[model samples]
Target: MKLLLSLSVIIGAIVMASTLTCNVCNFRFLFVCIGSSSTISCTGNCSLTQTFAGSAPFFSQQACDTNCVSNTTTQKENVFGLNYVKTCCSTDLCNSGNSAKLSLSLGLSMLLLWLLKCV
Candidate 1:
């Protein structure tokens, strides 16, 4: 029984240490955002050519494109360009290097305690 308990504790510690050492990033579907810039008119030799009077800038469009993952995706506020993203994003568990290390330490400690109880 003691041998089994010791083995379990060691295995648990190893597993926890390995598992908590990796980074896991998860993403979820959110909403969509619809925005339009003022009409900008353009003059061209060809009458068929269409001109934008006040079309949105490239940066604004880029931001919208980046945030707008899909057609159904929308957000509370429509941000233009690379100004700011209104979507919610937070790092938990395996976020940055430091955060992951801290999580690993805690997990290892917990595994050790559990192993002790088994023994």
Candidate 2:
């Protein structure tokens, strides 16, 4: 029973830590923001990472391209060669790094943790 409880705790920690996080700036809050950047930890079906690249960036529940997985799009929000890009990915902070490399690292890290716990 003790071993089972310990394993449950470890697994719970892993799950909680594995939640999806995304760069959310000027989003969802009615109050004025103190900074231009912040993070949002999603829950349930809101499990996706969205990134918007533009001079005036914004995101919200309706603004987010929810259910977007492994997709990237480039759009022109202004004149000149400037482009406003919107990207979506799965996993924690995956929009910040190359998804392929991050996936490998995440897999390895989870494996390592499980292995450590076992040994």
Candidate 3:
């Protein structure tokens, strides 16, 4: 039982330490963001950026960014006629359509189950 518990803990730690993966895609024209067909892994965070003209989003890009920081920067519409917003997250496949919160929840649930079974 002790050995099983140690093995389960090690597996959980390895999963938590794995590199983050993010969707990679670029689209323009409207607010609709098509699902990405490709993905990339990064040591830092995944980034999703969207540009808006007036109040509507017109462009979006998502990919792995080693230097990404979680924040939003907006430009005055009068100066550039557009606004830009970038979101950075650190998690596996966080830049995809799936929510990071959901991923975290599932991971925790699995770990708890494993620990319970071990005990």
Better of 2 and 3 by lDDT: 3
> Which candidate leads the pack in lDDT?
3
Better of 1 and 2 by TM-score: 2
Q: TM per model?
A: 0.21, 0.35, 0.56
Superposed model 2: Cα runs more than 4 Å off: 1-19, 27-36, 43-65, 78-81, 97-119
Model 2 agreement with the true structure over 1-119: per-residue lDDT tens digits: 99999999999998887566664443222222223444567542222222244454343221223555556566664644445455566655544321122233455677699899999
Residue-pair clashes per prediction, in order, are: 16, 0, 0
Q: Candidate 1 lDDT, tens digit per residue, 11-87?
A: 98876543322122221111111122121212111011111223421111211111222222222323432222222
Residue-pair clashes, model 3: 0
Rank candidates, lDDT, best first: 3, 2, 1
Query: Relative to the unseen true structure, what is the C-alpha lDDT of residue 8 in candidate 2, on a scale of 0 to 100?
Result: 100
lDDT of candidate 2 at residue 45, scale 0 to 100: 21
Candidate 3 ranges with C-alpha deviation above 4 Å? 1-18, 28-36, 76-80, 98-119
lDDT of 3 by residue, 49-118 (tens): 7788778777677778888886666655577788878889887777665322223345467769989999
Sort the candidates on TM-score, descending order: 3, 2, 1
Highest TM-score model number:
3
List candidate 1 stretches off by more than 4 Å.
21-119
